[model samples]
Target: MVTQDELNEKGKAAVMDFDGDVVAEIAEECISAGLDPIDLIQNGFTAGINEVGTQFEQGSLFLPHIIAASEAMSAGVEVLTPVLENLSAQAEDKGTVAIGTIEGDIHTIGKDIVATMLKVAGFNVIDLGRDVPIADFVEVVKEKKPAIVGSSALMTTTMVLQLQVEEQLKEAGVRDTVKTMVGGAPVTQDWANRIGADIYAENASDAVVKCKAAFE
Candidate 1:
């Protein structure tokens, strides 16, 4: 029998190499070995992405590398999603959240990671994709009406779009009804408070913790 640590290392390597097929392959192996899906996500895929994140911040990894790793992590998570849904039936859905990068910001790797972590943590995630307009967020809040809305912006220029989103959400009259979460490299807790955001996530793992706290 393969040890959990060994499986985790495989998962990590797959993401580091940006090999989506290998990531899925490791996920299948974990399933065959009866390992928990969440554990695999954390120890295997998330662990790898976390390293990729560090390397990215330190300049050892480039944007394309980060994107590839995120893609690999996403593929592994897709493989685990069904099994997680089954687990969710045994547990309870935390809440619904809509996530996206703000308008004019094409960066998405971090946002994608947060979405995956949220999903594994039992949240129903509605990903709005990258470079999403503020109006779309307001419209989604008016239409989909998720419990929370999250925005990501990688640049100081684009980060203000998160503030704009909050303003629009308030204008739409759903501000009081929904919680707004903000995150990205340029985002900070003070910034979140200044922007009237309900939550500020530092990373993918922290995002899951904060999302759970919002409901709890």
Candidate 2:
């Protein structure tokens, strides 16, 4: 059985090495040793990613390193996700957030970051991935009853889909059921308000703050 200190060390090195497989193995070991998935993620994996983000921003790390760290964190998440989901505390949720990059928008870096941040902050995120159509958003909202729905668009052309999603949600009579939030390279708070989205997050971290506010 791996000790807690060893697992923590492995988790930290996994991020530094950008080794997703190593991260996953460490997480699995921790679980096999009876460690809590939520605890590992919140205290270990999240801290690693936040550090990577800072380093990347400060030019101490390059894009390749960032991608590797993201991949490693994602791998750890894959192993921990089921365990987290089965835990009673996780089931209760800080809040349910449905997220996606609008239709015609294949850009996902921003959405991925926001989703990760939300997860780190204890929000249950249902990510729709990229290029999601209007129907998916409406169907998910109806099925999951999420407290917040978020959309991202990197291009002006794809930004229109954010409005389309809002319109569909309204038409489905579930607009009021969720607080809509939108963001990306070309989005603005005014645009969010104009399109009937309840909030606009300026960045990934800001998304967490805004969603927290919406839930509060």
Candidate 3:
């Protein structure tokens, strides 16, 4: 019998090793063993990716490694998506969040991870997807009235679009209503402050922490 701790370690190793097949296998094994999928995601795979993020920050890992690990994590998440959805349906609603990658930047891996983490954390996440225009964010804020809006930009050029999101949100008369969060490789706390964003998340776990703190 595989104890939860061992399975958790296997899940983490699968992601750290960038083995999508192993991650998927772990996901299936968890389901078969009736282990909590969310537990595996949060404590196992999410923990793995969080370490990867730390390594990247410390210059021990690079973009390619991050991308591969993210993909591997995504594979495990895909297998758990159905179960997650079922569990989420029965769970109490947390605050809503609208998240996306800003215009001119089509990067989705980081954005996807954050969105998934938020959902797993019990937030009703409206994923606006990659290459989202500034106006779309404003429209969603106006229409959905989510508690938080998150924008991602992988390039220095596109990071300026996060500023535009702040400006446009104010223009739409919802700047005060919703908190704004900015992230991506090129985004820094300084840039987030310059753009008047309420939160600057360095990675997915940080995003979940700051976003949850917004409502507290």
Candidate 4:
């Protein structure tokens, strides 16, 4: 029988190698072991992705490595989604968050990372996908009534769409009901302040930390 520590190390290694098959295998093992999917993700897969993000930032790894590791991590998460859903039914929600990229922003890597990390952190996440229309985000906010609304844009051109979401929320009379968080390559805390967003997370780790802090 494989020990949990060994499994954790394997998970980390699989992610660093960008081996989706290996990740899925480990996920299956975890499920069979009756492991908590959230713990598996947080302590195992996320640990690896965090390192990948660090290495990428330090230029030890490139964009392809980041993308591959993300893919592997996502595949592993897919294997555990049902377990996560089952656990969700028995636990109190941390928070409900709606996330999306702006209509003109096709880049979704950063947004996807945040979504997965949020899910692992026990947030009820409604992912609106990349290039989502502002109307759709507002509509979901009005309908789902999540505690936080998150928007991302990798480019300066589409970053303004985050403002549009805020405006739409205000126009729809739901702005007061939810917190707004925005992030991306061109996003800064000052920009978030100027845009009237409630929070500005620098990266996925910061996103989770800020999200937890918002409620705590």
Candidate 5:
């Protein structure tokens, strides 16, 4: 059996190589070896991406490298997600969150970071991706009934779409079903409150903590 450390190391190497297929192969091996999929994601994929994040923030790594690392981590998730989902059925959720970037905001970096951190923190993150339609957000909430809904915006012009989402949720009759969280580069805690968002996160870790607290 391959040790968890070895699998993580291989996954990390795959990220450094920026080879998606290689990352998937390594993740599959970890799964076949009976390692916990979440552990593989954490010790392997997320660990590598977190380093990418650090390097990116420090200006030691370029945007391309950060993109590559995210691609690699996403590839690993493709291989391991089914296994993790099976376990999730039996595991207690730290919380479930429906997350997306608002319409007209094509940015995903901030939302992706929050999703990754939430997953690492044991939350079931249903990421709706960038430029999501308002109906999609409401539909997902109706289906998943998550503990929280998170919307992110990068551009100031697109920030109002978050409010649109809130209104849509109200019209759909599930506005009170879940707490709302909003964040992005230009978003501040006061702005979140002003827009009726239940909370705001300056970064991914903060988002994860806020999500955990919302359910507690």
Candidate 6:
């Protein structure tokens, strides 16, 4: 019999190794063992990605490694999506969030990680996908009436579009109804302030924390 501790270790190792298959296997074992999938995700998979983030910050890991690890983490999450959905159905809705990469930015690894983290945190996430037009964002805000709208821009040039999103939201008369969050490699707290964004997430973990706090 595989103990929960051993399964946790395997989950961590699978992510660190960037082995999506192993991570999926661990998720299956978690279900079979009647272990809480949320615990494995929090303690095992998320812990592994957190370590990878730390290493990236410490200069021991590069962008490629971060991308790979994010992909691996996403795979594990994909396998557990059905179970997560069932669990979500049984719980009270936290809030709704509409997220996307701003126009002209094709990069998605960072944004994808943040979206996954938000889903794991119990928010109903509406992923707008990469290279989303500014108008589309405003439309979603108006239609979905989500609590938060998150925009990601990875380049200095593309980051300006996040400001446009905020402006459009205001123009559409929905700015006051939804909190706006901006994040990316080139985004800064000062930038967020300059654009009148409600939140600036430094990373995936920080995004989850700040988004949750926005309600409190």
Clash count for each candidate, listed in order shown: 0, 0, 0, 0, 0, 0
Q: List the candidate 2 regions with Cα displacement exceeding 4 Å.
A: 1-92
lDDT of 6 by residue, 103-194 (tens): 99877767876786687678889999999999999999999999999999977899999989988999999999999999987799999999
lDDT tens per residue, model 1, 1-216: 998989999999989999999999998998889987777777788788878878888998898897788888888888887887777566568989999999999877678768866876789999999999999999989999898999998878999889899898888788998999999887999999998999999887788888899888
| Top candidate, metric lDDT | 3
Q: 97-192, model 4: which lDDT tens digit per residue? A: 999988998767678768876876789899999999999988988899998989998778999888898898999999999999999877999999
Model 3 Cα lDDT, one tens digit per residue, 1-216: 787888999999999999999999999999999998867877788778777878988999998988898899889989988887777677667899999999998778778878877877789999999999899999999999999999999878899889899988888888999999999877899999898999999988799889889989
- Ranked by TM-score from best down, the candidates are 1, 3, 6, 4, 5, 2
Candidate closer to the true structure by lDDT (higher is better), 4 or 5? 4
What would the TM-scores of all predictions be? 0.83, 0.61, 0.77, 0.71, 0.63, 0.73
Candidate 1's error at 214, in angstroms? 2.7
In candidate 2, list every pair of residues with a backbone clash: none
Candidate 2 lDDT over residue span 1-216, tens digit each: 666766776687677778888889888888889975655655566567657767776899976776777688788877876665455345346878999998887766568767866876788889999999889999999999999889999778999889888889999999988889999877999899898889899877688788888887
Q: Tell me the lDDT of model 4 at 8.
A: 85
What are the clashing pairs of model 1?
A: none
Alpha-carbon shift of residue 10 in model 5 (angstroms): 3.1
Q: What is the lDDT of candidate 6?
A: 0.86
Superposed Cα deviation of residue 22, candidate 4 (Å): 0.9
lDDT, residue 198, candidate 4: 100
Which of the numbered candidates is closest to the native, going by highest TM-score?
1
